[model samples]
Target: MKQSAYEAAVGLLSRRDHGEKELRSKLLSKGFAFEEVTDALTRCKEYGYLDDSRYCELMLRNGINKGWGPQRIQQSLKQKGIADSRIQEMFLDLDIDWFEQARVTAQRKFGSQVQRTKDRQVEMKEKAKRFRFLQYRGFDFEQSNYALEQLSL
Candidate 1:
């Protein structure tokens, strides 16, 4: 009369997408044996129900919406157990244009005030803070610099 591990896994997956490691861990925590969890995971993969590539795409789209830069995206995916090789292949030549994105984000958060500062020291300090914010959003050094420069103009 016991429910199958596969059934439980399917129910969990139906609620939301999960990375492989996360799924496996959840099932194990729920008392499913390792073999059963592995079998269920394999079936999920066979049915195209679990795919890191799809996960990557979803993460990328979500990151774009949240104004996250490529470096942050890369780190996030890696944390989800996505392979480095796949990450490179998937993101190679990907151009998210962090500079322009940063400018837009800055404008939305702290628009003309950034440009209106007459004190050179205060202006530079504000600019540096803005640059740090963009960097924290996962942009690289060059992208952050370009974004801060564009905002000044």
Candidate 2:
């Protein structure tokens, strides 16, 4: 016997949290009827099994823990079918200090004090390297600069 959409959805949710949109997509791809998927989604939401906000929070926390900046985290959540508004709201809810996060990430990656070199070219190279790292980590200019400043990067 074929499993119902709700059963499939519940099974997926039991393994890990999934965003509403992601769950719907998965169910539809598995050949469940559109209506069945919709009904299953509604039921899941009603049962407090599927929640975009909750899923967003989990993703946000994961991103932060992994040292990702706001831009990167937002991009990831968007790819996972999370709404921009929802991502922003959850970011606000998290009350993260992005500048501080950058500093922490820098300290974690680089040492507490950057080694100074007698060569001006080497110092410039070191600064550029560290700045690029922060930028790639999704930090904005101001935030990156602040972290670099803190690290003497």
Candidate 3:
């Protein structure tokens, strides 16, 4: 038997939280007609079964737990179709300190003795590598530099 649009949407939501855009796209991709998908989404929203803000908050917490930086998390949220204004608002309401998160991430990746070596050239190379790693992990230059300093001390 074919599932109704509402049934399919509920099934999907039962497994994980989804942003409205993501849920709409997923339902459409599953062969539901646009009108059916829209109805399902509207119903879901009305019943509080789908919420972009809730999804964003969950994603943010998960990203932070995984040591992701704010830039990286922002990019991920954008890719998931979250609005920039909402992202900014959510970030403002969040209590996380990005710099502290960066510092912890650096220590976790490089360890406490990250700067124990005394060779100037080798130390420079290590610092450069660490900086690059942090940059790639989505930290800005200032945040990366701060993390490196914290790791070195």
How well is each residue in 49-135 modelled by candidate 1, as lDDT tens digits? 887778778877788788888888889988888888988987875776667876776666667444565688887787788888888
Q: Write one digit per residue (lDDT tens) for candidate 3, span 11-75.
A: 99999999988888999999999999999989999999999999999999999998889899999
Residues 1-153 of candidate 2: C-alpha lDDT, one tens digit per residue? 999999999999999999988999999999999999999999999999999988998998898999989988999999999998888788777777999999999999997899988999999988888889988989999999999899876
lDDT of 2: 0.92
Clashes of each: 0, 0, 0
Give the CA lDDT, 0 to 100, for residue 41 in model 2.
94
Single out the weakest 10-residue window by summed lDDT for candidate 2. Answer: 87-96
Q: Residue 89 in model 1: shift from native, Å?
A: 1.3
Q: Which candidate ranks first by lDDT, i.e. highest? A: 2
